[model samples]
Target: MPERPEDDDQQLGSLRPTRYATLAAWAAVGLVGGWFLHPVSELVNATAPVVSWAQPLALFLVAAILGVTAHATWRSVHVRRERLEPHRAVNRLVLARACALAGALVGAGYLGYALSWLGSRSELADERVVRSAVAALGGLATVVTALLLERACRVRNGPDQA
Candidate 1:
């Protein structure tokens, strides 16, 4: 007569991998954001150059930390040396997915902004291009780290893997 909670849980158990279409959608949003922010970025850079350098460094550091953590978690699980708490693992997986999406958006936006600066002869344009490139690299690192983290969360053929 009534649906059981277990039935809901069963439906949710069929976990699927992240889709490329989702990533592409996020990237599209980022492209729009970058296009819209280009003028503002130019204005900000004219006043202060710190953000252009700092943002990329921050993103890169985040990526590195996530990557290391993912590696450790994967190794521990693969060897059966440690057990990951269910809640913690779930949280990490969610974080990884969010980062992956965000990274794609940020990377696309930076690239778009950089492209907008191409063909400009001003000294500021040169600086913007370099900074944008660095930021884009940081974004790429974030995406890679997130993807690795997601992969690490997958269970192999074991009963407790999920």
Candidate 2:
């Protein structure tokens, strides 16, 4: 049977891009805050005792925390939007996406650094590393944006069945 306009509207209404936008905005703010606080690419240079793992790990942790903050805000609004207390089902989705975004960011940063480090000295290496880093950053951001958009869809439409 064909879907009705009401059904389509329901589906559309179920989506809440506002929530995702809010989350992204908050995360971006957190990132800006981190930048101001650090005043340098802390992710690139290892500042702690464990440089080997600390750099990437720190970046991941920071990004994750920011994601968490964003998710929390999303959850709050979701709860209010649905006129119900935060649902575990929905909250879990938000958390999962946030974690995924954080992981992607960390991975991309590390790969960028590795590519650059491996290709050091020569102009070709420098160019290659820079290209890789930019690509990684763009990919991560796209993933994050997609995830957030998906979450927004879920918020409005309820979870999709597998």
Candidate 3:
């Protein structure tokens, strides 16, 4: 084997790329917990708080931020026109991964919450279902954007670029 340079890059820990199965597992956990949330609340005569537009709005905002960052990363890394600092790139990659897992869990939770509201007699059920579904959609977007950002953060050179 050829001798390698002694640099910090050689010492930095490498993390495996995020996988669909891992995300699915986290979502499943969130779904089960969220599915039970309503029944548990009802069992204790607790009031289910009404969901509003803000929940989905906030989730969408997070997705938008990730999307924007992904775009910038793609332009900088893929185009070969600019270079990102090593630390900044690493930080962004970490952020993307963390957000991807969070998005899956959050999206699934909201989806399960929406499912739980189906066939319910509560006056707010309709609103809850609608808002929760929209929130779930936002969570999906966050996951997609975060994954894109993670891919964009990869530093490739020469024939292995793919």
Candidate 4:
């Protein structure tokens, strides 16, 4: 027998748990990728002194963003085809937003440190501490932003939390 619309809606809600599972899996993959990217990027930085400019690094970051966007787009399409609202995939969106914010903070922090290192006359300990504090603040901001986004999405898509 063909499924009823309510049955479909039930199935659609089921997608939420599946989406959460996918988000968890993707988070694991991202963690592995982070490890891999670190050594690879460090090696590139250490060995390829010729191309360590803003342009190449910026392009690299752009490419990484594009790749992530593509992955998200594909997953969103899949969810839509299953009759689910993409925004209801809260877990995935939250995870992606958190990761994106974290990455942005780390990249900006490293850039700040590099600029300070290049401009400073001495490698002062206090300066290092200040730079680290700045990076910590960036991480805190990212966490706050992720929490806000998640809350917003939840309020828009679901009933109010008690």
lDDT of each: 0.80, 0.46, 0.87, 0.43
Candidate 2, 53-133: lDDT as tens digits: 334445445455545655654665465454334465456456556555554544454343444345346434454444445
The local lDDT score (0 to 100) that residue 8 gets in candidate 4 is 69
Best by lDDT: 3
Q: List the residue pairs that clash in candidate 3.
A: none
C-alpha-based local distance difference test score of model 1? 0.80
List, residue by residue over 1-162, the lDDT tens digit for candidate 1. 876796576567656667889989998888777766766755877532323688789889989988997898788776665777888788889989999999999988887777767797766878887888788888889998998988888775445553
**Which lDDT tens digits does candidate 3 get at residues 1-162?**
676675544455455689999999999988887788888877887777567899889889999999999999898878865678878888999899999999999889999899999999899999999999999999999999999999888765443442
TM-score for every candidate vs. truth?
A: 0.82, 0.33, 0.87, 0.34
Among residues 3 or more apart in sequence or in different chains, the pairs in candidate 1 whose N, CA or C atoms overlap within 3 Å are: none
Clashing pairs in 4: none
List the candidate 4 regions with Cα displacement exceeding 4 Å. Answer: 1-122, 156-162
Question: What's the lDDT for residue 131 in model 4?
Answer: 47
Off by over 4 Å in 2: 1-9, 13-50, 54-86, 119-162
Candidates ranked, most accurate by TM-score first: 3, 1, 4, 2
TM-score attained by model 3:
0.87
RMSD values for the candidates in order, in angstroms, are 3.2, 11.5, 3.5, 10.6
Q: Which of the two, 1 or 3, has more TM-score?
A: 3
